[model samples]
Target: MDFRPLAHFTAQDTWLNDPNGLIVRDGRWHLFFQNNPHGPDWGNMSWGHATSPDLLTWTRHPVAIAHEGPEAIFSGSAVEQDGRVAAVYTSAYADGRQAQSLAWSEDGFTFVKDPANPVLDRGSTGFRDPKVFRYGDSWRMVSVEADERTLLVHASTDLRSWTEVGRFRDEPGTGIWECPDLFPLRLDGEELWVLVLSVQDADGSRVVHRVGSFDGSVFTGGPPRLLDAGQDFYAPATWTGAPAGRRVLLGWMAQPTYAGATPTSPWRGAMTAPRDLSLARVDGSPVVVQKFSPEVTAAFSREVADLPPAALVRCGFDGDASWEFRAGPDVLRLAVEDGSLVVDRRASGLVDFHPQFARVDRLPLPAGTTGFSVLLDRCSVEVLAGPLAVTQLVFPREPFDELRTGGSASARVFAR
Candidate 1:
C-alpha cells in the first residue's frame, strides 16, 4: 500500500505538528509548521516551509527556521507588515524555558532571527505560542500560559516591542492550553469574536473554540466547545493575510497517543484540508461552521473514482442513517442514531499499530442535520456534518473498494 494522501498536506519526509505561521502573502499561501527535519519522530523543532497558489496543492521548501544551540523554534503565527513577513514564535530553551521571539523574511521563505531575541519574555517557562494580528492602529498578540490555562494578551506597535494588556482564563478542561487564536466573524451582520486553542491532558489532545466579544483590552467569551468533535484534530491555526472577510483554518490531524507510532514512513503526520469558516446561528446562538475550500470542493465530484488511493464521499440523510466503507473483511462504519453521528473504527483494518487507534467517535448533530461530507484518505477520515466536524486517522489493511449506505440517503463519491 500506497498511503499518500490526495488532498491533505503532509511533510515531504519528516515529522511535523502544530501548524505555525499560517498566512497568505503576495497572493500565495505560506504554511509553516513545527517540523523535525532530520527524521519522522518529533524532535529538533524547527519551522518547515511550504507554499501554494491554492490551498489544495502545495510545494515543500527548506526548513524556514531551524534549531540553533539550546533554542528550538516552536509554534506561533505570522503576519505581513511594512512589506515584509514577520514570524512570532516560541523560543524553547533546553532548560524548559519558553518565550516569544521574532524573525523576519523579506521574501516570505527565508527568515533571519531578531538580534534582540525573546521579544516578549515574562521569565515564565510556560508562556508561548504568540498569535499576532492587526487591531485598530496597532498589533495585538494572544499567547498562552500553557500550564495555567490562561491566554495572555499583549500590544505592540512595531511587532518587536510588546507589553501585556490583559489575560483570559479558560477553566473548562483538565489539560493545559496552547495555540490560542482570537479573531472576528460576522453572524447576521453582527460581529462576534472567536477564540480557538488546544488542550492536552492524560486522555489525549483536543481543540476548542468560543464565540464572544473582544474589546481592545479584554475578551469575554461564551463557554468553551469542541472545535472538532473528534479524538484527533488539534492545534488548529487560521491564516492571517486572507482576503477581506475570509477565515481559513488547518489543523494537525492526529492525536498524541498514537502520533509517534503512526504506520506511515517518511512522514509522521498530515494536515486537514484548509477549511473555510463562517458563523451560523443555531438556536439563537452563534456557532462556527466549517467547510472545505472552494478549490477542494471543485476538485471532488460525483464521478471520477478510479485514480488514487483516496476519495471524498458525500451523503445526505434525515433521522437514522448508516454508511460503511468496506475493504474485504475490514469495515469502517458511520451512522446516525438518536440524532448523534457515530463513527466506528474499532475494526478499521490495520488497527494493531496502536491500541488507542482503534476506537469509536460520536458527535451530536445539530437539529435538522440533513447531510454530511467525509474526506477519506488512506490513513484518515474527516467528517463534516451540520456545524460539527470530526477528524480521525485510520489504517486500513487494504484501500476501501466499496461504500455502503443505509436508510433514505443519497450518496455521491468523488475522487481524482
Candidate 2:
C-alpha cells in the first residue's frame, strides 16, 4: 500500500517529532522540528527546516540547526526580534544534562550559535523545551521540568539572562510533561490565557489545555481538560507572527505507543494540518474550539462520491447516524451515539504489524453538534467537531473508495 501523504507536512526522508522554532518571518512560514538527520528512527536530534507560502504546501530546506560535539539541539521557539530572528532552545549534553541555549540568524535560513551558549541551566536532566514570546518591556519563557511534570516560567529582558518568576506543576503526574505553550486569546471582549501541554506514559500520549489568567509572572488556571481525545495528537505548538487575531497551531501526528513500529520507512512521522483556534462558550463556560485553517479547507474543497486517498469526508445528521467507507473487504466505520463521535478502524486492513494500531477512538461532541469533519490521508484520520478533535493513524491494505451512510446520515466527500 502507498503511504505517502499529499496534504500533510512530512519530512521527505527522515524521522520527525515535536515541531520546533515555529514562526513567520518576512511573509513566509518557517517550520523547524526535532529531526533525526541520519536515519528514519529518532537520533542525532537536530532541527529540520521547511518554509511555506501557505500552510498547505511546504518546501524543504537544509538542516537548520545540527548537533555540535556532545550537545544536541532540542525543541524550542523562534521570534523575530530587533531586526533578526532569534531562537531559544534546549541544549542537551551527552552526560544527561539539559540547559536552555540561544541561536540567531540574519537571514531566516542560516543560523549562528551564540558563543556564550546555555544562557539558562538548571543542572537537571529533565529541564528542556523552552518556548519564548514577547512580553511587556521584555520577553517571557515557559520551559518544562519533564520528569517533575512542572512548568518553569522565566522572564528575560534581552533573551539571554532569565529569572525564574513562577512555576505551575501538574499534580500526581501520570507521566512526564513536555512541549508547553502559553498564549492569550480574546473571547467576547474578555482575555484569557491558554496553556497547552503534551503528556506521555507507558499507556500512550495525549494533549491537554487549560484556560486561565497569566499576570506576566504567574498563571492561575482551572482544571486541565483534553485538547484532543485522539490517540495520535501530541506536542502541538502555535506559530508566532500570524495575521492579527489568528492563532494557528500544528502538532506531531504520532503517538509514543507505536511510533517505532509504524510501517512507513524513510519517514516515520507527519504533522496534523494547521488548526485555527478560537474561544467559544459551551454550556455557559468558555472552551477552545479548533477548525481547519483556510488553506487546508480550500485544498479539500472538491466534492466527490468515492473516497480518494486524501480527502475530507463531512457528515451531518439530526439524531443518531452512522457512516462507512469500504474498499474491498476492509471497512472503516463512524457513528454518533451517546453524545460521542466514534471512529472504528479495527477492521481497516493492516493492523497486525502493531497491536496498538487498531482501536476505536471517541470524542465527546457538544449537545447541538449536528455535523463533524474527518480529514483522511494515506495512513491517518483526523475527526473534528466544534471543540472536539480525535486523530488516529491507520494502515489499510487498500485505500477506501466508497462512502455509505445510514440512520439519517448524509455525507459529502471532498478531495484535492
User: Local distance difference test, per candidate?
Assistant: 0.88, 0.89
lDDT of 2 by residue, 44-80 (tens): 9999999999898899999999998999999999988
Error of 1 at 280 (Å): 1.2
Candidate number achieving the greatest lDDT relative to the actual structure = 2
Model 1: how large is the Cα RMSD against the reference?
1.4
Worst 10 residues of 2 by lDDT: 355-364
Residue 120, model 2: lDDT of 97
Estimated TM-score for each candidate: 0.97, 0.98
Which candidate number has the best TM-score?
Answer: 2
Cα RMSD (angstroms) for every candidate in the order listed: 1.4, 1.2
Per-residue error for 124 in candidate 2, Å, reads 0.6
| Residue 341, model 1, lDDT | 90
Local lDDT at 185 for model 1: 95
Q: Which tens-of-lDDT digit does each residue in 225-248 have in candidate 1? A: 888988779899999878776899
- Itemize residue pairs with steric clashes in candidate 2: none
